[model samples]
Target: MSLATTKTSKIDRLAELTAKKETSSGASLWREAFRRLRGSKMAIIGAIVIAAFVVVAIVGPWLAPYAPTAQTWRGEVFANQGRFVGARGENLFGLDHLGRDMFSRMLVGARQTLLVGVVSMLIGLVLGALVGVVSGAAATLGGRAGQRLDDVVMRVTDIMLALPSLLLAVSVAAVLGQSLTTVMIAVGVVQIPIFARLLRGSMLAQGGKDYVLAARSLGIRKRRIVLTQIMPNSLSPVIVQATLSLATAIIEAAALSYLGLGNPDPAVPEWGVMLSQAQRFFDNAPMMSMYPAVAIIVTALGFTLLGEAMREALDPKLRG
Candidate 1:
């Protein structure tokens, strides 16, 4: 065989091997993360619990046998009025003070709880990301101006962080008055500092990396580099933090509601409101509090577990 032909054959063979290697090791980051998540039993359990809550939130009212607000009298009381009864055939979870079905109220409350959690999370994520991205990008300005901008933004975040999250949320809720919207806004505002600080730190760390420097050397637009390259790379931690923050938002909303700072209308069913009302009947019907409290604990646990598992999966240092 000619020397040139032999060299061409060797080149073709090397190309084939490279293609095979690429095919064998070409999984995307998300796909790898998912594979790691699937290997985690806690993650699977958390996912199942979260899915159940989502299903309950979506179809709970339809699944309930009784109207959340309808009253059913049992024993006769003063002036021929019948007193409320506990659990019965028609009412699986039993009756509240006014003879309202506990199970039905709980079902409706699930929808409210999930709605507040999701909406508040979205609000926090959007506002926080914007603040963090802007603050981080400002560092590119360099010199005294950059330092001043960073100091100003970070001081504002520090001021917010100085207060306890719950206290801040309570203050906002009080100002907004008692309503679901108030609870959501309060919780969302509380979350802003946390996400902003986390994302700002992430972006700052990424800004000093080789890839960012390379992009700068290529003369990429400052905005484009920040948005497209730096932001996307820094989002893994933010996404994990978001999942954890969702659980916190849910708990905070419930707390505000329990304080009578949420949905003033007594007829409205919400986990926190239900817990507040259940206080009156605690002696006779402790299950009222039990149900709502258990629901809150389980939901929070699910989110916590899921967030931890995601962190483990996504972090290279944690991967086995």
Candidate 2:
């Protein structure tokens, strides 16, 4: 056989192997990742932390001993004289500057905190993934026209990425006006560029592989190829990123709240709003700030750990 025939045979063989790997019951990446995750200490710890936080966010408020906003113990604490009450029999987390129950406020605020992170991450994921699918599919399948479309999309994302993430979110919040929805949108917008870029790059990488080349050579429809083959394989990094972005979303939401661009209602008990309130008495009563701050840090850490574990588990290099 000619050298060209030999090369073609090798490519065909490689494609057959890839197709078999993709179709095999035991070749599932998600299932393999789950098995790896189960064995990972980091994943276990992170899961525990996340589960505890979620349970608290869901149930802790219902069992709160005192009203989060009530100042029934106001007379006991004196902010003017810098005399704050420490944790005691009556109040577990001690009194804030306003003499409100810290424990109760934290419990009630957990829901809002979780809500902000989840909503923001979802907004980013949905919008960014849509953008990525268009850009990636075009660049890989649309030929010259596709490349141009991808270019236009990427250039816009690049501009957004060029700006500092926090600055962009702050600008968005500033434009939208202060509210919880505004915060979620602002934070979510900041994540769009990251996801778009990641997914587009991932799909492009997949486009060059033997399976894709074989599919193209076999006269498959571009849309079917993209939707069925390329899209599924390219989603690994994006999935991991979504997990990591949750942690970032929570922190960014809090930052917005700390900047006074959160829910306008002072009566609402949110972790970010709570932190903003605690900053005033940080010097006088550090515990007021400490509790919420620690909570935020721990929650972020838990997500980060889980994300890292997932990345490791999903790594193709470790499949052996």
Candidate 3:
């Protein structure tokens, strides 16, 4: 063939390859996962719930009709006789034992509740991810010495995991004493082992993949290979774990608060604290407890649903 004809044929082949790549089902892992996530009913519902919750957390305090700590209708509530005022024209959610407006308290408390969950989860994620990276790096790239280091780290995480999560949180709270910081630290500590173990295992799996071997063969630096290749591939599980951890962190934080280890200020309304105090008059004022309990459940469920949806989307096995 003539030289000009051969050059034209090569250009046509290149165009064909580019077209095939463009028409592939997934553009990239994250984009494809997001596409799948958008189609999931559970994800849609969870996203809506979480969005509403975040809005409330951000503005609920400002929008509250009355001061959350105010006993505006003290005389109206007769908790001893189970005669607290039901939902009235003024107090939409009725009055608590102390005649505080349930609606107002619920609104103001949302910020604190979300703060505890997000901050505690971040605590676990940062510290746990740090440990996992160190351990996984040593095991994959450090030769025999690295393997031993990994063994020790894994053993420590195993010990932490052996204990019941709630019991560990309670123990931490007791040692730290009663405070909002104590509750966040306690709940966050419980998640460390879980996130650490998950990330480490994911890295180990990814370390043996074909791309890692190819990177090694290409004379890529160890640090570069781990950071650019293995680390990114290993993050899917960690991301999913972070989502799931948010749900558990909220529940555990609430449990600590209910146990009287959460924020020392009684005037501040925390959902868990509200639930704890409402039990005193639960027989008559079920609405007080119901309000917080339902809020907690719905919030946790939203995170759980979103986490589950993410796990499915990120799983290569689930890909078509």
Candidate 4:
């Protein structure tokens, strides 16, 4: 009846509406992601392409007619020795110098590439989130000590950003000496600055919000405030950064592998390694270069599309 009571009722009504809307079938995050994804034709196509690659990567061994590492004399052959030019009958993508099945190898290569990319990006996400949260929330709240640490972290980030990512991966991989694990670490390290900077911005924006201040005023532990209050609000941008970083990380891994700085064994199937091998046979076997190249491009484009769609979906201004 009174003005204050009416205002309280309205606030409660708004909260109920918001909760209902958020819980609706198409209004949840994943559903919203799918909805926004469908709105972009290119993103949808990219998703399909990426999904196909994943399926192929998973089932390729079964589908491949011959062993990827099998070596036969008589120079080389492909795809059960069919009329597909590089088919070679037994070699789907044709044979390398050692008569290995290019198609079979490529199938295995996709799995390795995806593994490196996803793993490296995951490492970056964890490290970057910690660093960014500490740099932003701590520096703002910790006073001079936090500020000093923040400055150091920012300088490191700047130095990292100034370095070419490929060059960094090459340098690190060169020192670590070419193993799949090392390749993942190298790519992940290169990606940390990207995540850190984005996260710091998100944290700083959320740090001074009313809820955060209220939590602080309630004598909540700094960790709780940072984790619960500031962190939640900062997550949107972090998610966006993560999606984009997956693409960058994949490229870095591929470059490292291509340079002979990944996968200690020459026999290991990796798209980059396949490309490296194909270079020598360019004149005789152009398709050798084409398939892997197209695969990498399509995969990268898919991540980019997905990232763009995520950004748009998460953007409040764009969503309405």
> Candidate 4: what lDDT?
0.73
Clashing pairs in 3: none
Q: Could you tell me the C-alpha RMSD of candidate 2 in Å? A: 8.1
| Predicted structure 3: lDDT | 0.82
lDDT of 1: 0.78
Clashes (backbone N, CA, C under 3 Å), per candidate, total 0, 0, 0, 14
lDDT of 2 at 54: 95
Model 4 residue 200 CA deviation (Å) reads 1.1
lDDT of 1 by residue, 1-320 (tens): 65434533442332222111011257655677789899999899889989999999999999987788776542322223433355778778777777778899999899999999999998888998888787777875355787688779877877777777789999999898878899999999987866776677777767777878998899988889888888887776678778888899889988998888988898888898899888876876688888898999899889989988887776654444
Error of 2 at 277 (Å): 0.7
Q: Give the alpha carbon lDDT tens digit for every residue of 1-320 in model 3.
A: 65434533442332222111111464676787788999999999988888999999999999999999998777766534547678879889988888888999999999999999999999898888889888888898879999999999988877777677889999999999999999999999988866776667677767877888999999999999888887776776777778888889989998988999999997798898888888888887788889999999999999999988987776565667
lDDT of 2 by residue, 192-293 (tens): 877777777778778888999999999999999999999888877787888889999999999999999999996788888989988887877888888988
Q: lDDT, candidate 2, residue 235? A: 79
How many pairs of residues in model 3 come into backbone collision? 0
lDDT value, residue 100 of candidate 4:
68
Q: Among these predicted structures, which one has the highest lDDT?
A: 2
Best-to-worst order by TM-score is: 3, 2, 1, 4
lDDT of each: 0.78, 0.84, 0.82, 0.73
lDDT per residue (tens digit) for residues 1-320 in model 4: 65434533442332222221132345665466567768888677767877987888788778777667777532424443422245646455666666667777888788888888889999888997788888887676777888899999977876776677788778888888869999999999888876776667667666666777888789999888888777776676667667677788877888887777888787888887788777777876788788888888888888888777766665444454
Q: After superposition, how far is residue 141 of candidate 2 from its true place, in Å?
A: 0.2
Query: Model 3, residue 295: displacement in angstroms?
Result: 0.4
